[model samples]
Target: MRIRKVIPGDARPARSAPGGEEAARDPQFVEAIARGFTILEAFTTRDSMLGNQEIAERSGLPRPTISRLTHTLTRLGYLEYLPRFAKYQLGIAAVALGQLALANMAVRGVARPLMEALSQRLGASVSLGRRDRLSMLYVEHAQPASAVALQLGLGSRLPLAVTAMGRAYYAVAQAEERAAIDQQIEERFPERWARVRDALHEAVDMHAALGFTISIGDWNREVHAAGAAIILPDGGIAAFNCGAPAFMLDRDRVLREAGPGVSEMARRVLSIASGKG
Candidate 1:
């Protein structure tokens, strides 16, 4: 295979620059992309629908900069400006991008069988995840064929401080990284952080002792989970987890039945990552 070098002055035909300068040389265009993403991120749980001023305040960009970014994003169909309410919201383009990304995950092929086997053997919800910042994005999930089952699927994102899998991942992280994650969680989600921080320290220590992390009703009420992490080549944490309704399975049962398989699968993934497969 031959590698093609990117010429410094190359430009894409669809989006032409004013001169023959390469796209990388345009600092103004770079800033525009940054400001646009910042504007989008400004709309969070606390402020879902935001006006230009709110977006500016949250993003720390000037009001005029936010207004221009919003206009560009709205024009690109990534944002919708509500003229009647004078607010901006995420539009269909974002949903379309999410759908496209999920479609490419190959969850059914790679993870479904493993999760199904784990679920049936343990009589629980077995989930595989890829960590994303403070969240765990589900790669696959398999639940028992019970009527009162959790409806989580491949695309669901679980908070790191709130889910067993998330804690397991954090426990496997280095001390410094875990501390940084802890600080961010405490700073960002202070309410939940206050309730869980002390227990989380104990949980981290317990994971070191027990070789896994367990949580009961941490993320979802009445949901019990035991989880372990698979350390990837780049030191990112992926996880395997099993959850059940509190009355259905206890921590001992989860560890005894589900822990081995999850850990074995994690080892297999790590081994493959290490080029041993």
Candidate 2:
């Protein structure tokens, strides 16, 4: 069977510059590099290995283009060709790049202790995340020593529409940025927008009113989470989230107990991040 094409409409909007007129006007933009990255991103946890045809379908590129790009990437050590399966998987270079990126982020070092302490105190999983395109990318994570926690790790990504971390980040974003993201979400997930739109607005309002947001089974049916955002001394915005299994943290408890605690923790973290603590 032919692999389903992963068209632009099937995925989140590009976090980079807008396409069409905006892209055409940018003379310094490199389309080849962007296309190469797109091809690399076609391999996922579920789709770990892909042939040139599958990569072409998933990246919305022509087969010939994918063939050339894949070969180039393989030569650069960004992808490894699997002879047995006749497919390609991420290479050690990708892991090295990701590790280097994480190693250089100062905020992760600054937030690790606080996240550890918070997770220990609350018996929940604590995560630090930043905006990656339209999703929240986990940069650092901590879990209680003795508790069973969510199996999230560095580089894990959650949706911007329903995750508490995503909402918290959105709430703190500038008006124009938020508007652009909102428009993109509406366009990307039109079928689900009506159901999620009102809840998203409510989350933003809650964050504005209470310094944090709560999500109970909104993103995942088995999880409950709360989040708040902080602006680092370097002016980068990041969100911290605490989450637990739905069986362990019900909706009322999240709103009544975890919500306030997470909010206060966020404020303290923000103070530390801003060098005011």
User: Among these predicted structures, which one has the highest lDDT?
Assistant: 2
User: Could you give candidate 2's per-residue lDDT for residues 73-104 as a string of tens digits?
Assistant: 99999999999999999999998998998897
Which numbered prediction scores highest in TM-score against the true structure?
2
Instruction: Show model 2 residue runs off by greater than 4 Å.
Output: 1-29, 45-47
Worst 10 residues of 1 by lDDT: 6-15
Q: What local lDDT score does residue 247 receive in model 1, on the 0 to 100 scale?
A: 70
lDDT of 1 by residue, 130-238 (tens): 7766677776678766544555655566777778888888878888888888876776668878677876776688677876777777676667788888666665666
Which pairs of residues have clashing backbones in candidate 1?
A: none
Residue 23 lDDT in candidate 2: 52
